[model samples]
Target: MPRGEKSAYTDKQKRQAEHIEESEREQGRSKEDAERIAWATVNKQDGGGKKSGSGRAKPH
Candidate 1:
């Protein structure tokens, strides 16, 4: 995918990024910077959408 393209991310990842971005913005980051940081964080945590299937199973 092209740079800045988020199509490879899962819905949950996208939501996580959105939350991160919002928090960054609240901390005074610019919109672009916040989004960049958020996506970067998600990538760091989840490894950039490479694996198939949901990651570690949650307990019931």
Candidate 2:
């Protein structure tokens, strides 16, 4: 898939992912870990589809 392109996920899937992310954040993940999970599940790099936590980190 190209950058910015999207794949469909069920509403339940999305909600579940959001919950996971929120939980991770609440648990105090080093920003890097949080960004990775966001990208993996939501397809948004670094939480906003671009450099987050500086250019050193790549979304997972």
- Candidate 2 lDDT tens digits, 1-60: 576343445455456567777778999986678656755865442243323245575435
Model 1 C-alpha lDDT per residue in residues 1-59, reported as the tens digit of each score: 78878888889999999999999999999999999999999998987874665686634
Per-model TM-score, in order, reads 0.80, 0.44
TM-score of 1: 0.80
Assess candidate 2 and give its TM-score to the true structure.
0.44
Report the C-alpha displacement of residue 43, candidate 1, in angstroms.
0.2
- Alpha-carbon shift of residue 4 in model 2 (angstroms): 6.3
Question: lDDT per prediction?
Answer: 0.89, 0.58
Model 1, which residues run further than 4 Å from truth?
53-60
Q: In candidate 1, how many Å is residue 12 off?
A: 0.2
Best by TM-score: 1
